[model samples]
Target: MSIPKYNEIMPNILRYLNTNGEQKFRDLEQPLAIEFGLSDAEIIQEYDSGNGTVFLDRISWALSYLTNSGLTERPRRGVYKNTELAQAFLDKPTEEIQIFVKQQMALRTAKQKAEKAEEGQLDESSDLLMENNQTPQEMLNTAHESIRQSTYDQIIDTVLSKTATEFEGLVVKLMERMGYGGQVKNAGTVTQASNDGGIDGIIREDVLGLGKIHIQAKRYAKSNTVGREEVQKFVGALAVAQSNKGVFITTSSYSAGATAYAESLNGTTNLVLINGEQLAKYMYDYSLGMQTKQHIEIKEMDSDFWDGMQNDSKVG
Candidate 1:
């Protein structure tokens, strides 16, 4: 069978529990997975909070739900056995799977209400742990992205207020890391004389060593957006370069008028814009002038060398 949905996994669980008689939660997972055509990877898709994919944590939740709904009973907190509902379902074979699942859900919903009435919220932090979870490195990267967005935004805002020389160095470092060293001509290399069309830096984009596209970087405040006039000037510069492509980047949001102006394609140049958020994300992903922090270690089992199996006679 194809990979089943969240609800569909339950009937298979009931079938397994009914046939197996009883099993520890940990023990049930593998067989349950195998019977349902799920590999270790896909078993976790059957929970309420499955991060858009399945995890062993979801399998745990499935077990908890089964226990709560009266289809399974926990002999101990961790041990599970088939309940009357599970037994009955096995006795009466149903071709209509949907009805059986609905019945199972109804029982669990009622059980949850009864439990809440009897005891206030018991700590469920343990319940949050997902099964076959992500490695620490993957999780660390996820957390880092969140941290860097806020941290970098603040840093970018602060850097924008600094002297032009400081800004120049920061831009150069970031740009160099982003693979634009040779392509970038001035790149804060030469200080613009006075106000030169508000164009801060110049970059040459060569596609596979063929054709060149010019780029202009603008760093501004959050409130500031590249207006039509600014875009017009950039377009004018592209015309001077006799180029059909240009990039206008800012450390702030873009105005709709400015965006429309670039999109007008006025039979001239194609101007691409990248705002603050996009810029920071690219920088973060590319690790552009950014330092890596504490690495998280993800644990795994070594099955190639099992912990030396005992002889059959030795156990007896």
Candidate 2:
């Protein structure tokens, strides 16, 4: 069965606390998983951002909502118990409980906002109560991923519109920015337009130019698939240049035959194939053809600091 949503988990949490007495947060997870009849895989399914498991995240938000609604209390850190008010909620249907919690949370938010405004310290921030099932962190991750994908699409489109020579120069610059060429001036160069021997660009791996990496750039549309013939031609170009390393970058995917051919020559020739998706990702990661519009930092409490204070009090 699919894991229950946060609101759906609320009633079960209340019932467990009421029956089981005070419990630590970690101790609640197993029993809750059993109650939901969730498979091991479902319980451990990670969010897209790889932050935490979806099941645990939902459980955490459920507990937070219950605490804010006065249905539960944390008497000690990481330890939760049901309050007398929880008894009233235990008998209610899950839908009614959800509605009550939402209303209580709304009231709490309004009170906090009013207090902040009175102090002339009100800033634009989202309310603590989330309307969707996702936790606050998950929401932020989704937004970040969406923005990145949009930027990648825009970059690919812009690159596609440029001339072939311009595209070759761009890839060479990208290689230099990616820590190739080792601080050498003009270490990467685009070849002349005609009679370039299939190699569009080249990067000297060191200042002395003892080692070199040949580049073949193909600015093909998404509909076009680079085949083994193109890869073979690049390999021939590498042979002509007396180099064993080459990068074949294209704004389109490669055929299975092309990928297999490259893999077959793994020991004899070193070849790196960068497709449209991978190319855009590399550009975004290296901050090429894109600029940062905003940056956000997420922070958590320093348990060590509080622990030190407690130890100091004991010594006192």
Candidate 3:
């Protein structure tokens, strides 16, 4: 079965804590997965970002919503229990519990909006007031992904507008930023355009230049596909350089034959291919050709601090 939504998980969390008494936050995952009849694979399903499991994220937001609604309380760090208010809805329908949580969330949003307005920081079109089924973290993740995709498109367009020599230089800089040369001066360099046979750039693996990585950068349109013949030529160039490590980066995709050829040489030669999307992702990840516009910090309660306070109280 598919994993349950955050709102759907809310009522079950109340029921689980009511029956199980105060339980560790980690202990709720398996029982809740069982309650929803989720399969083993579903339990381990990760978000697109691969930062966390979907089930765990939803369960955490569900518990947070219940706590905010005053239906549940955390008596100690990492432990949760239902409150007297939760007992009233223990026997209610799932829809009823969902409605209560939604209403509570709406009221909280309204209060935040008012506070922001008083501070002259109101954003009417913000997702803060959007009525959606997604949990808070899901919404943030979606927004972040949308921004990243847009940035990737811009990066491709900007790179396509630059000269061929400039494109070669950009890839070399990207390799350096990715720590290819380990802080060595002039570790990555674009070859003189006329002198370069097929290799556009080269990166030293260390200060002594004991190891080298050859790079082939192609500035092609999105519709252009790098075929097997192009990949074969790059491989021949690598052979001429007597280097087993090579990276072929393009602002276009590779053909099926090209991909197969690269894979077939896995044991003998290490050939890495980077297509347009992946190239942009690497640039963004390494902060190449990208500037930070803003930073948003997501903070959570420090469970250790609270646990220490409880321990001190017990000792006194």
TM-score of every candidate: 0.53, 0.74, 0.83
Largest TM-score belongs to which candidate? 3
Give every collision pair in model 1.
44-54, 44-55, 45-54, 56-131, 57-130, 57-131
- Which is better, 1 or 2, measured by TM-score? 2
* Per-model CA lDDT versus the true structure: 0.60, 0.88, 0.89
Q: CA lDDT of 105 in candidate 2?
A: 82
User: lDDT tens string, model 2, 180-281?
Assistant: 898889999999978889999999998888999999999999889999999999999999999999999999999999999999995688999999989999
Let me know the TM-score candidate 2 reaches against the reference structure: 0.74
- What tens digits encode model 3's per-residue C-alpha lDDT throughout 189-265? 89998889899999998888889999999999999999999999999999999999999999999999999999999
lDDT over C-alpha atoms for residue 175 of model 1? 57
Off by over 4 Å in 2: 1-59, 85-132, 183-185, 311-316
- What C-alpha lDDT does candidate 3 achieve relative to the native structure? 0.89
Off by over 4 Å in 1: 1-145, 181-198, 204-213, 264-268, 302-316
Tens-digit lDDT track for model 1 on 138-252? 3444566678778678656776787765554555456555776465444323237375444455444443434454556666777778788888888887777667766676778
Ranking by lDDT: 3, 2, 1
